[model samples]
Target: MAFDEGDAPGRVVNGLSVDVEDWFQVGAFEGVIERDSWGGLDDRVERNVHAILNLFDEAQASATFFTLGWVAKRHAGLLREIAARGHEVASHGWDHERVFRMDRKSFAADIERTRKTIEDCCGERVIGYRAPSFSIDQRTPWAFMELAEQGYLYSSSVAPVAHDHYGWADAPRFAFNPLPWSDLVELPVTTAQFRGKRLAAGGGGFFRVLPYAFSRWAIRQVNRDEGRPAIFYFHPWEIDPGQPRVAGAPLRSRLRHYTNLEKMAGKLRQLVREFAWGRIDVIAHREALRLEAEKATLHRASA
Candidate 1:
């Protein structure tokens, strides 16, 4: 499925998203900083998110904000502002809890609680979810079911690459029905082929660590070569280089989080200007429509 007929022949409206969590809540800091210490830490999320909103506004792009319940509750005004500005407000689990860390029951409760909190803040039903650190994997076969039960329509949760923290290397690279009996879609984050290997092209530490030109080329490859819209995501804290640094984070984590921090916003502005981007809902809707049209065409041909 493509974005619209108005686009130039070889373009698609890729999915751009923001994972709205504070800097202290990152998985990299999970080891060094206790979760209870979150409330006492400096909160840079609001200003950073506003900067992001302004960036999106300036570029005339819309994106999905997969927000944490804890963040949403504390920054209810910011959540309302995000919704007011025409971007989608979706759910990231409460306080950045990874799915693998929670059992089915706790996972279910997390889904319901977070969804309700986000909906209450934004005054809209939350249909999309992205797991913290892309933590949902084959071990949690019940993850999608829990989301389906909570009334989420799609999840941008799985990462189809090998990683030390989280990656389901065998999952499909694009959006697909993870559950045969339900309509919930599992939209794995984007990846690009390089030297006979698939690398993480969707944002995270990868975006910060890699040169901007490579990221541009990789995304272009995904759009032009694969004929599929890519889903790119990054956290709000990515743009805030001035934020307080976590003291005890490991060296590797420090490198991933801190490298190119000052350059992220400029890179993001270029990204917004150069590409066609939209919310996950819009892209997923187009995919569903494309499938329906294909089925109808096949039926007519068979007849």
Candidate 2:
């Protein structure tokens, strides 16, 4: 998505991200969707994800898929298809736990488990992460440093902007390093400064919830006006609106989770056409290296 569609002092860098997991893998629904039930849902998972894969393939685009360890373990073929088609595999943690909710040891273990699972399935070492619910924010800022220590090259876990479940309200919207210890890159989800508030860009259910016009405007504002790359994220099930709806979820969440699924694919296609986009790793790595070089120059100058 373009940060500013028309006013770009710089080109809008686009990165598409997908949290690859079954419907049961989402954090909010973890409480309601028992993990044991996930195995039996494999067909549903592949069907949903394959549709997304096919869409990206049709666009001649690639994305970073932050996959659940459980899903990767059982659905190796899905992970393989994503890799075969040129997408990058990344970790979404095991069991979809909120990072801040777990102790450091537990959190690290989750990362390792998920990373290994993805690597085993895709034959590529997973180097990035996007925490479930965007939970690696201020409360779990340590997660970034820990991820670096675990050999991760970067993380897309911080939403940066505030939300009901997760955010580092003060963090930068563009890609940057989490300082003091982390060498890992932090790529926050795209949110634009609109009328002095951070509103979600073309990412996740937020994109689904807003009028398509608003999302396009937000993304364009970021690209053209703000001079930053925009990261758009969505789940596999989002495009599969016809999937069975869950029972007993909170009314608001049920609404948030299910509303407009049928329209998501069309919306996604519109989004891809409206802006230039690439894989998150490509964007993140290119930016990280550039930033590092810039930092080294500044350090030399200061010295």
TM-score of each: 0.94, 0.92
Q: Write the per-residue lDDT of candidate 2 for residues 46-98, one digit (tens) a residue.
A: 88888888887776666788888878898998899888987888998988888
Question: In each prediction, how many residue pairs overlap at the backbone (N, C-alpha, C within less than 3 A)?
Answer: 0, 10
- List candidate 1 segments past 4 Å from native: 1-10, 292-303
lDDT of 2: 0.80
Question: In candidate 1, which residue pairs get closer than 3 Å at backbone N, Cα or C atoms, i.e. clash?
Answer: none
Name the top TM-score candidate. Answer: 1
Cα deviation of 174, candidate 1, in Å: 0.8
lDDT for model 1, please. 0.89
lDDT of each: 0.89, 0.80
Best by lDDT: 1
